[model samples]
Target: MTTAIRRRGPDADGAWVDTDRGVALGHRRLSIIDLSPGGAQPMESADGRYVIVYNGEIYNFADLRADLEAAGQAPGWRGHSDTEVLLAALSAWGLDRTLAALNGMFAFALWDRAEGRLSLARDRMGEKPLYHGWVGQGEQRTLLFASDLAALHAHPAFRPEIDPASVSQLLRFGHVPDPASVYRGVGKLAPGTRLTLSADGGEDAFVYWDTLSEYARAAGEARFRGDAIEAVDELERLLGNAVLRQSVADVPLGSFLSGGIDSSAVTALLQHNASGPVKSFSIGFSESAYDESPHARAVAAHLGTDHQELIVTPEDALAVIPDLPGIYSEPFADSSQIPTYLVARMAREQVTVALSGDAGDELFAGYNRHVHAHRSWPRLARIPRPLRRLAGRAMTAVSPARWDAAIGPLVARKAVGVGEKMHKAAGVIASRDGDALYATLISVNPDFRELLRHPSEKDGFEGRALEIVAGLPLPDRMMAMDAIHYLPGDILTKVDRAAMAVSLETRVPMLDVDVIRFAWSLPADMKLRDGVSKWPLREMLYRHVPRQLIERPKQGFGVPIHDWLRGPLREWAEGLLFDSAASLDEYFDRPAIAALWQRHLSGAGNHQHRLWPILMFQAWRARS
Candidate 1:
């Protein structure tokens, strides 16, 4: 199992087993913080009761160590590694307390030999991945866990059985949510959760921390009472501390600079704190509309950092498609995964660790959906339900192309393709309520039921939708919903897998617990103000770089998948859809799939979003 995931930690590997206790632990080391052999894992404690095989870095380990020393709890450490401090802290303060004090990304397994118990835990925001489950039955049952699905596949006792419900989730959201894996029986451990198994085969799983609960607590108690300037200053201070903590590492480190609010903000802080110029990396495209390298270059020049940029052609991006299935190990249809992988690869060439400006969108109201919900939902809700339905139907009566042509001259041009935006807007108008409306807006395949051969047995969102902040405005609700769902499930997963594929560790300072709490405490207007999203974040960026260099329509990190499907990838897509149309019938409606592919090829409409998920699923299925 450990060998299967050598890509994640190519530096070193180790394993420990206790035959009498019927237990074993394994680790593949990346050797980021401490380079000596003393930093190796499955690391054991001084008293020899606890042993752990951990993944990820502890950014605040130095401060934690200082606190322990001042309190006279520090053991004569063998080396200066976060792993050693973590073990000592676990011994000193116990599991729950140690987890609460941690402010870094991690997923680990700790075994208590004296108590004959094994515990598994993930970080507060699901930045690192962990999967666990029991195999066999009764007396023969065995529990298995790993950092990635490929490792689980390597276990001799593991069985691979597709979970239809997970497939439904992939089609619905473009990625499966937590507590469910692509395979039956096995499950991805939820973020901020811990699972402990006893010698008797009994188990317990509980949340050590939760983003929803934190948001609720902050909403009820930690509401930001300061004015705009105070809020921005406080935000900058929190962000600076977060970045400084993450910047601690033994090896070379840098930040991904996309010139967007999030990445640019992280880069600015990193450079501000670094004694030398911070190393920065970005990936660009020859395709003008899809490129953001110019902005990134301007930011790097202003920040006076050592910057690296790679301009990839369509062929360079297309070359990554064949490896996506294995790299992700599940059906993830986020097209941005391509650019993320390319950028990660570029960073890997110069640095061992990189900080990203992820979670800023989720923390603050940065998604277009949040704005759409805020601007359109109130007006739509005022209309009677029947009248709204009539309007929605009328909007759909005219094809998206006709709507675009009719409104093109009257309204200003949008960043998104007019036809695609109009079609999506129709879906929003057709929603029945907030939950349905948010789901429609986020869904890549809203009519997944029509595409599948059988009804999904598992309810979407696990029988209930998110209602973290019940009484908040529509925008806040949407932002909170995404924080709990989309941010960790899709965005974090994509970055984690893509970066780890090349043995590079990516950290998100924006998701620091303090940052999350503070962002949620502010009123919705503070986040999205005067028709601009991520207002406070922009304020911070403007402090470091001029607004003109960064201000523009938000161009998401994306590849030109729509153009590729019609041009370079048409043959490959057709073979997967048409050549195997009958074979795919067991899972999909062949005729429906064929029609969608034909329409996309004929340019009737841009069906890339819908088709991408199906293609990803098929690609993964073939590899599995």
Candidate 2:
């Protein structure tokens, strides 16, 4: 694993193994802070109570170091590496308190010699990736972990198998939900949680922190902003400090310039703080509609950074898709991961750590669905049940099967689902409003009402998220659901697996726990006001970059999957849906799948929704 990272950033690599204590920690040095060997890891504390292997930048390490010194515990400074400061901080303050003080992106493993235990933790928003697995049985069992799943595959104990429910969910949501990975044996450490393992490999996982619920209960008036001026000013202050802190690397560091508000904001701030040109990288697609390189180039020129860009074709993306199972160590179907991986690979060639603008979307309610669902709520209520049903049937028939294959269907299935949501909301909200609305918005699978009949199915999957928001007021629940669901499951998972696949460490400044708590305390209207999503976040961006550059409609980072399935990927997709050599009977109804495929091939409907998950499952099966 260290070797792979070395290839990505070759400045240094350090490793230490305690055979007596049954622990091993390895680090690939990027030398972002205190570039000397003193920053080396596996880092041990002066008292030898704790040792740590960490991946990420700790923006507030200097401040944290001063705080530790003020507390009357000063270890002689070797170099100004936050890595050493972090290990000492743990020894001085212990894990729980130390974690609370951190304000950067990190996934670290700490071995406590005194306690005879090893603890693994990811940052609050999961900006870093951690994968763990135990192989063999009984006394011979062994636990292995790494920043990416590919490293885990190096162990002989790992196997490849698809989890049926995971396949269903990934296909529906474009990423696997947390606590469950695509792999059968391996599991991802949930964001803000920790796992402690004994020398014997017995392990216990626990949540040390969860910011959403905490913020929901915070006194709102403390950080409350009554208008855009206050919102923008506070955001600018919070984000500028976050960027400044995250920039505390001893080695060369850079930013990912997406030309979007988030990345642009980061780049602008980096330029302002740095004495020399800030390094920046951007990945583009051959499809003009998908390409944001032009925007990135403009932003890079505007910022005067040492900029680099790469234009990847669909063929380029296709080449990487098959390798995903190994890269992710589980089933993850986020198509954007293709570009994310490519970009990270490009960035790693020049810089060790790259900062990103990821959490702004989730924190500020930037998703279009949030807007669409909100708008449809009132309109959906006005239509009478009989009229909705009649309209749905008529709309479903208006576009014939042939027309669907050619022109795509104008089916009211989506509209009907939208209409029925009102009635469903009534039924669900009657029990609890936050729980129901959250459930309604997040369910991406086909009407699983019928699928629920099977005893083997994971029940109430939609309710799982709402359960996190059960007691919160509506505004907080909305933010909490995104934090728990979209942040870790989609955004973090996409960036971590993709970035680490190329051995580049990507940092998310916006996800600092303190920043997240402050954002969550704001009212929902601030997030989505006057039909605009992320209104507060936009105002925040304006404080740094001109608003006009990002004033256009939100163009999400996504692949043209709908078009790809019908274009270059047709044969591969068709084989999975119909002539699939693998036996899918254990998980899917083969005949039903064939029918869905025929429905698409014969122009009955667009089957990409049903097709994507199955294809991914089959691809994984073939690889395994």
Candidate 3:
């Protein structure tokens, strides 16, 4: 089981078990903060009453260590590793106090000898992955947990059923949401929550922290009493502190610089806080429309950091396509996964840990939908419902190919996927409510149920975003929903899996607790003004790098999967899509799948968003 996820921790491996008590634990070490043998696990507390196997860094371990000593409750040190610090702190402070004091990404399990109990916990922001569940029935039932699903599958008794609901959700969102894994009887532990299981077959789950309640309690009650410039200054201070804490690593470190407001701001801060020059990594494309490397290079030159970039070829990206299912260890269809893995592989050559600018959009209202909601929602709402639906249908009725043929001169091909964009806009224009509107904005296929063999009564997540930010402005509500849903299920999951596949660690200082809370407290005007977005972030980047070097129309971290499927990848895609012998054939409607493929091929529409998920699932299911 430990060997199955060796890429997650190649430095070392260890296991501890008490057969007499029917308890066992395993760990694969990715030595970052501490490299000594004393830092090895599965480690036991000094009193020999507790044992733990943990993944991820505790950025505040040193602070907690100091507090322990200050109170004269510190245990004799085993090693400098945060793993040891965690065990010691948990022993001294007990569970609740220790969990509350923690400030970093982590997923871990602690075994209590005296009580014969096992406690599982994940970080507040869902950075690290932890899964736990029972596999068998009655007396033979077995409980399993791991950072990757591949590890649990290594167990002989672990037989899981396909979850149809999970498949429907994946088709809509591109990645499976929290509390549901691809398989039945297994779950991705919710971030900031814990589960305690005992030999008596008794178990309990608790939420130690929640983003919604926390945002409400802090941002609602103590809103930042500052103007836009003042908010920017406060943001700078908070992010500066976060970078300082996250920079404390024993291994070589760097940052991902896309030259956008998010990455540039993070890279700028990383260089400012570092003792010497910082390393920066980026991925490039031959296609200028999809390229951000030049911007990254300009920013790196300005920051004076050791910069590296990889100009990836179609062949380079093609070589990685076969490994996507294994790298993700599940069915995931974020086209950007291609370039993200390429960058991580390149960065791993020089740095063990790389800081990212992810979550900036969620925290500070940087997405296009946030802008649309603020600027267009009122106008959209003024139209009668039936007329809006009629207009939307009229837009989609004209196939993308026809739209491009008719208006291609107006909207250039450089904007690639222009017709697809129009189709998506049609969906947004026709939404019935704010919740449905945001759902349509984020989803790949708003009508996903039509393709399912057994459609769900409804996908619970569509309305979930509205519930999270019930009374906030549309822009604030949209961003807040993404901070909870999209940020974790897709963006963070993609980065974590892609980086860990190469034994590299990635951190997000923008997701730092202080930064998140502060962003939420600021008024919507500070995050979005007039029609512009991420106002404070732009100001911060300008202070370190020139405005021209940083400012540009936003571009996604994406690959040309739509083009590939019609070109070099077409043969491979066909084998999976039409391979009647495949497992996905049993779940997805064949006629529907074939029609979508034909439409994409004929340029009637850009169906990559819808097809990619099905292809991913088929590829993953083949091996599973």
Residue 367 shift from truth in candidate 2, angstroms: 1.2
| Candidate 2: tens digits of C-alpha lDDT, residues 525-588 | 6677888887777776666666666676556576677667767888877676556476666666
For all predictions, the C-alpha RMSD in Å is 1.7, 4.6, 1.4
Arrange candidates, best lDDT first: 3, 1, 2
Worst 10 residues of 2 by lDDT: 413-422
TM-score to native of every candidate shown? 0.97, 0.86, 0.98
**Best of the two (2, 3) by TM-score:** 3
Model 3, stretches more than 4 Å misplaced? 462-465
Write model 3 residue lDDT over 102-184, tens digit each, in one string: 99999999999989999999998899999887887787787899999989989888987878888898899898889789999
Top-scoring candidate (TM-score): 3
**How far out, in Å, is residue 564 in model 3?**
0.7
Compare the candidates by lDDT and give the number of the best one: 3
TM-score head-to-head 1 vs 3, winner: 3
* Model 3 whole-model lDDT (C-alpha atoms): 0.87
> How many backbone overlaps does candidate 1 show?
0
lDDT of 2: 0.70
